[model samples]
Target: MSQGNYRVAIDIGTTKVCTIIVRKRADHRVEVCGISIVPCDGMSKGMVAESASVTVAIKESVEAAAADAGVEVNAVYTGLTGSHIESKNRWANVPRSEGMRPVTDLDLSAAKKAAGAIDLPDDRRLLHVIPRSYALDGLHGVRNPLGMHTGELHIESHVITGSISKITKLHNAVFDAGVRVSSMVVEPLASADAVLTADEREEGAVLVDVGGGTSDIAVYHDGSVVHTAVIPVGGFQFSNDLSIAFAIDFESAERLKIKHGTAAPELAGMKEEITLHPTTMSQPLTISKREIGQVLKERTSELFRMIQLKLEEPHLADIPTDRIVFTGGGAKLDGFLNIAKYIFQRKVRLASPRGLDGMPEGTNDPAYSAAVGIALWGMRNLPAENHVDERKISHTSENSGTATLANKQTAGALSMIRGWLPKRDKETAGT
Candidate 1:
């Protein structure tokens, strides 16, 4: 909880908004110090439907974490994902001037910028431009072309784009909550950072993060990202399916999904039953666990089938699916691994954050994986913006008041946020 050694990140999900505060240890490693979750309003499928309501929810989540960490939070790093998110691979080759023999940061920057010149609608904006690899002077797949003598340079990049309106709504909500976003990470990349192992990323891996409203797909091979996608279906759909099938309310369906649903109904005991309290005009209904599993199985299977079709896209070119990791709220379903194994037909592992400290026991669930990933990503990349105490800010703005919206002019602000702060060896530092 020491002020100088802390960083915080927030995940604005459809089901809830979660804030996590992490503290760097004496050894320079990080540990969880504070964690907060609040019900989200005015958000659906990762878009802000109402800035006013979302702003209040953002404040509630941040303040809860601040209170737990005993330090105020003034800025946070957040991530975005929705069906509107799309991706493509781009290549840019630029010729250098006569005197400009060696590649420079400016050249690299220009090359990256060139890759985004592809046509797009005015309502859309670039979300991220990740360099898959660089080539200098005819050498291919160069990790860094810095200071290399070359008449030309080329870059293979992964470009992600989304609706400008959706991003601006998110920005306004956080801003009106009185915090500036240091940066924005795409949800799949953030989760991959937190859950995917170096070996997996290097040898070819895929991360499927099925949250309340969207399922994000990211594929990596040769130590770089190759494909990314957002599927419109996710855990929320399963809950809705159960709601209609059992004649129960949405909240009750969600609870039923969490408590008894399974992806493989054939494995469930047929006689085990769950009681559903009836509404005003009906008698209580008793549904068998086998039936619950059957309903969930049909829906979850369809979702995975949809994911399969996405992976089979021609542009993906069959990147290594040798390893697949599952995270997020839906991954908790019983018999999930079996279903995923059958659908993905690969080695599948259920994953969450691995090396965190100070978190409450059993609080480490698939649902919170992306939130933890956001904190890890921010602490590694973004500078810690100085914290301002709650006392100095006005309670008037904190109230349910209307906010004037503001938007930053450039799209590259997010593209430039990827840099790891150097860390000294923890054990050797204090010695």
Candidate 2:
């Protein structure tokens, strides 16, 4: 594709809708040319609850982003997440060609077909079938097997499937807003693309994204996503707790939480107190900081504990706590990393998305990590090669069999390597 062609990514998150525009440069680097975010009025946890409200919000965000980038967008790669979605790894075996020659595109295609053959509810559909790795004979971890001689080929993948109705609703909403849905990516996957490094993913790590209404987790090992799940809790729940406990309005409670909330009450001094304005009372009320901390700790700990339980699942046992990386709006909370460290009993660090140009200071906040990552993903995954060389269309059709897996693995591995490599060396390396 021409370097000037702009790609747009829309993150229809729970509490906010964000749109980002990026362009691929001659050097193959992606630059964030524009961004726009608006409060989500009719969506919750990445699902559209009110189509009209969501359509309006999406259109406004898109228009704002287009205006900033000085270009119009005809289609967008959207993000999707919710408690209803599920992801799992499955394996499939495909036989070699009749002559028992090297693995062919047909074999890869067969493997993908097998992986996508899982039984699901009538209202569900597969969103992504990401190959984790290929196995030739008994040798696993084979990244590319196109020309490799093997009698049997085995493919492992993370199959992401979601509610068909929800996905359809999202498509319709975007369509109503006068845009085409080029693709739909899982939210955690997009966030992981934006933040986590390759070494972290290979060495085993978990990415936790604490958005306004939900906490999404993706576990990685050996440079592939092993598990992904969502917890129905986030910063918004903390605010709700404060609002109810203090008998105050939501806005006031949010302010207090942002200003004074802590995940550990034992660390707060008993003498400390915070003022609260109750909804019914005429006078402001004073509440102990320790008490507020205790409440915050309870809810956050519950969320973390659920994450721990998910980690306990056999599929996620390889994830190491020492490699944990936290992102999202909630990661910005004061003392949150401390609390996460205490609960997980390991080193924890806040992760932010990088490698974009023209991003505003505040827009660099973790809250925009997913949106920015989506933009990067679009630039990298969209059919750029098709646009670049029309003559290569037939090659694209042949490679589509393994392109999804290869692209994701390449992206994941390159990101991990970039995080740990020396500045000069990483700059010279290709993603």
Candidate 3:
């Protein structure tokens, strides 16, 4: 394997911190060079509570990954999630500065900069401003307007923001861990990139990543991201539910869920049972698997229902996508997709990273999708960022540098995303 470019991605979830080292081969396929996954402490729902504990968790994961890859890393592309993260569509109309000149990437950059004028609360700051589409004059839905003469260029983009305190806590934790946050990627964005195919993006889709601590959503259409959000509820809730119902330790409960839980209880055998030791007793107790499945089904159903309400509140109920793609650790549970289909009432699919070379054993699962995708995101996006945060970074080009705050006003400019879908149904239709 030729060492072309190697990158590290760190995903800090409520239950664990994972660091992955991926190396791009000469043929452009990525390989898993190393991996480190450790239980996380001092975090809840993606927000860092205790900096010292988070720092330790990050340090251990990165060091373990480095040791395995036989390469020391000083910086990383870190994933962020939580209810604190928000996104919206925004646009900026830049009159051709040159007066009837061919639009270039610079013009596009200016439009993106213009769209950065978001009105965020004092507690929040911009994390990412991705150009969604370009429009020249009145002709719209242009992927790129470069090399074409136009009097004005309109830039529509998706801006992701996070709480100032939450952002700072994450930065401090990584810095204390002896690494720099090169760039920030929304967890759902990375997960979508890794799991979604080109058709999924161009044809419209919603990616639901049920991480350990949060469920991240990325709605894509027209080959770009239109909306992104984070829900604090996640797979942890399932484990918690089981723990309370069976009076077992959290660890034991989680194990039970992974091994036997299902989102569709009717599909499970009611007579099936498993015995486990309770936290307070040396004696083992037998529990019906049917009961466990019922608990899981209820929890997951409630989770999807909440998500549905949020979408409606934002008037995103009509996001143009026929399929709902589920990923993340929770998606690993049996019958999760069936539950999603039951709620969304549209086509549903499971997603994971595809087309990788030398993928490590047990690393190609949906759980690793974001880690793999964020590394790829770091590779493809390092150039568009002219100024990045002053952190040690990889895959940086001389043309790109700092990660600074983009204004909030540009957060919701011109926002229409298009893609393929099953013919709209009257019962549960897309608008």
Candidate 4:
């Protein structure tokens, strides 16, 4: 019920919009206070197709969540994904003028800033500059260089960028809905944060979040993200394939897919048949369970091949991770893992949202992983921004004891705003 304790997240997907409000507990786990999922047709393949419709859906979803939580919603951490999303590793070196001094926090910050200063094309916007690792004076793979004596510090970072036009469209849509975007979270990162285990990340793993319109991929090793990508295929394509193959309406096909679809036909009663009475058909029609599975199987195989191709792309093939975790609605089909295992020939498992408390019944499925992850990301990272801002203000006020009255008033106003909405972290600029 308190303003500073609540964090809201809005995950705008191709098929649905999900808004969740959570409260941070004293134990550091987030408790879901309110959640809303609304059907949306305003987006296609993660991009806004109809801005007005997306705005209306965002407003409706936020209002419903706020009402359920009995709180006012003003800002949110929203998730972003699409084919336009791109990421690459960059490096930067910082030389300390204080010869061979212990590495300070300021040096690390400088390295990160330098690494993130890569020239981006005018059409692209930077989303996040995640620190991958640190190295000092000819040493590589140093986890933390702080307090270590070094004359020069080096930083490896992963820079995420997206199409400027697409990013602007999503931002405008959220703004038009009467809420400020506290941060724009990369969907794969959020999902990984929610579902991946600490061991998985440290030991190397891959997370595939197959959403309604796109499948997001993130590869992790050494406890940091090494590669990330988005494939332009998802649950929508599977259902559409069924619709086209069975000569049924989209809605009917969607229902049928959910009820009986499988990625492996032989495992799911290949000989069994089910009857359907579609709204478009006056008479009942007999549908084979195997046929449905066959259609999905082809698509599933193609998807796996696409994923393999993505992994095998230049600079991505040698990342050295065979463990793959699948999440999101698209991965919920029956026998989905069977096909993935057969195709990837690697360790594959389904993962759901973890590390949160008070999850509502039926909301712990993979479908809500990204939404839950966004809330968790906000809870973990947004507070750090506020802490940093407060530290800066305190240091300034302490150093300059003769602070003007206007400066004090401005600081007070900023403190009040920080209570409602934490400042965005500089490391995650534009997000």
Candidate 5:
């Protein structure tokens, strides 16, 4: 594959760090060229707790993927998720100085900027400002406002923000690992891109990405993101619950959870018993299958209820959909969907990564969805390699000229945001 066409994405999760390299073919489809997943232990609940350990893990994951693909990757698109993530809908109006003139791209950009002019605290950083809908004069719900005649153009936008300190730590970790961060995309958005269908997004759907340390949520309606959040509960909590209940080491508990865990205890065999010789235990231990299921059920139920509570927030109560899609490693637990359907009383399904070609067979699971989608996000948001002037970067000093190129790259990224869903042509709005 040509170097100019290679795109890399890294997903730094609590339990693992995943890196994927893809090459865009002549047909404009991305195909996996190399992929690597390495166990990580430097993060908790989506925030880096030990920068050194995270850097090491990122380095190992990236180098392995680069070696597998026989290419050098200098930069990557990484996923971000944590409880610090926040979002809200903001509206703005732009009155055309030239009254009744046809709406143009410049007018759209101005409206987006006006909507995104929020006063954020010093600790917070803006992530994305996505336009949900538009209005011309007093008329609302205009999908494409361009070319319309209006005295005032109004836009309702979804603005997403995150903690600057947390983002800086992650950025430093990736930099120490020897790759520049091309851009940072929220995890829920990336996972939704990998699994959600166009119809699901347009018709309204809730995407729950249950990772190792967090379950990220993204709600979509009319083909735009309306809400996003990160819950600090996931596979790690499930295994920890088992560990504490059984008085076993975390590794043993994790093994047991993966081998016998289920959200619905009633689905497990009533009399089946499992035996374990944990390193923490001197003698063999035997436990009932249903007992393990019962423990997990409590945590699983709590997580679902939390998700429900989040949806019950006053702004979300009237959302027009009852469909929820679950993705990521935790969602693969036996009986996960069965329990979710029972709790939410809505349509539910487990989804895996899509839209990429030549994915390795074992990588098609929900666990790899964020990583795959990060690659797709890079394809959509990052500037084309051919468009960047390599000579300017090579000749630029570390502090001055390099800064100019970085600014240009950042502008390119923001401009490429068009829309979060696949294939929309509107410009993004955010810092």
Candidate 6:
């Protein structure tokens, strides 16, 4: 936490790279100073398949953001996602001292260890172990039991886990970009931090981040992230479908999907058509817009169905219905909300990153939500006393000279995990 006021956050997605800079004011309000987005290459489904290429992409994006913000950033909080991430729920109980004394730090530590002792895959590692609620004796839902008196204490928690390899790759990629990796936050979790309100988390909510190669879902109930998963399908799949259906190159198909695709074909007139330039064919072809919509509908509906099925898991089914918030690039597709409503059988709305000042209007798009959220996350999580000396940070084209900053900072992780815990009502606290 160098007395530096600015923090940087980066989201390296499969299809796009985003960087954002935020300045924390004296009053604790965070302002966005700059943002940059670049089409991603050398990445697939949130994994760095080509490390050098990703390093270059990161370097370019970060430099652009630095220019816009009028300051250089030497370290950043990065976002990670993929199909390998998994989550689970567990509980722990601690007995009070023989005299039924108040809880102590030792008791809390024991509870955390108990909750984290659940079985996990050999190849995975725990990313977050978030406490949801604590019970003292028979009284449940106690938010802060630190000073409470009880014969016994019970804790329920959610544990989020991810592949160690994926995390390593993310770190290496950022390191190669000539910047220190301050933290590695799951993409959906970062997005939730930026967009979802505390009320939404407490009331029960789901955040769906639809990116190019994956759609990450985070379910929050009682102010804790109870479940998180990544579906290996996204906007890129739609583009691939269009390419195969229209006999066009992948680039052309992507352009067509972005410019002309829709989720509902029935809305288009039967006689309506659009001109398409198929790469294999020398002549321009006229295709039915409804036909394009039909293909998109098939794929997008399948995605929605998968999301529904994931939610139907017995453990997550209890979450309330009114708080499903959709964000990310795919959420911007035409008629996506209506399609989501039809499939999810619940109220749905688009969530954009907001509440920050000085961001370009283009940065307000849902496509940039994760990026903006990452920046805000950096602002809140990065230590206020840690600052990178701009003079020491080299602007050289090569990444070989950047020193990896060993981050011993723990505040960001605590704040992120705390945000997921249930909040106590004033009346209940008073009582």
- Cα lDDT tens digits, model 6, 1-431, are 22366678888987667787766656667666556665567777767778887888799888876665546778888888888888888778764466677888888888878778777777898877778888888798887789778887888888888888888887898898889987777887788887888988888889999887788888887877878889977777887788778877676777677778888777767668889777777999788878889889998889988888888888876778466899988778887887888877777889888857655544567877788777666565445533244553333322221121101112222232223211111111100
Candidate 3 regions exceeding 4 Å error are 1-4, 313-318, 384-431
Runs in model 4 deviating more than 4 A are 1-3, 383-431
What CA RMSD would candidate 5 show? 10.2
Candidate with top lDDT is 5
Task: Estimate every model's Cα lDDT from 0 to 1.
Answer: 0.74, 0.74, 0.74, 0.79, 0.81, 0.73
lDDT of 4 by residue, 111-192 (tens): 8788888888999988998998888877899988889997778888999999989999999999999998879999999999
Measured against the true structure, the TM-scores of the candidates, in listed sequence, are 0.84, 0.86, 0.85, 0.87, 0.88, 0.85
In candidate 3, what are the lDDT values of residues 1-431, reduced to their tens digit? 22336678898877677787766556566655567776675777767877788899899888877655556786788988889998888777775565778888777777877888777889999988999888887788888777988887888889989988888889899999998887888899889888898998988888888877678988888888888888877777888788788887776877788888888888888789898876766889798888999999988888988777656645355567777898887788898888888788989888777655545545567877777778778777774321122233332442121111011101110010011111111111101
Q: Write the per-residue lDDT of candidate 5 for residues 65-167, one digit (tens) a residue.
A: 7655545778888999989999998788875695787899998889878887889999999998888899888798888988988887899998999999999
| Stretches of model 2 off by over 4 angstroms after superposition | 1-4, 278-280, 319-321, 385-431
**In candidate 6, which residue ranges exceed 4 Å CA deviation?**
94-97, 104-110, 117-119, 378-387, 390-431
Q: Positional deviation of 160 in candidate 5, in angstroms? A: 0.5
Q: How should the candidates be ordered by TM-score, best one leading?
A: 5, 4, 2, 6, 3, 1
Total backbone collisions, model 6: 8
Instruction: Output the TM-score of candidate 1.
Output: 0.84
Cα lDDT for residue 35, model 2?
A: 68
**Number of clashes recorded per candidate:** 1, 3, 23, 1, 0, 8
In candidate 2, where is summed lDDT lowest over 10 consecutive residues?
A: 421-430
TM-score for candidate 6, please give it: 0.85
Give me the runs in candidate 1 sitting further than 4 Å from their true place: 1-5, 99-102, 116-119, 383-431
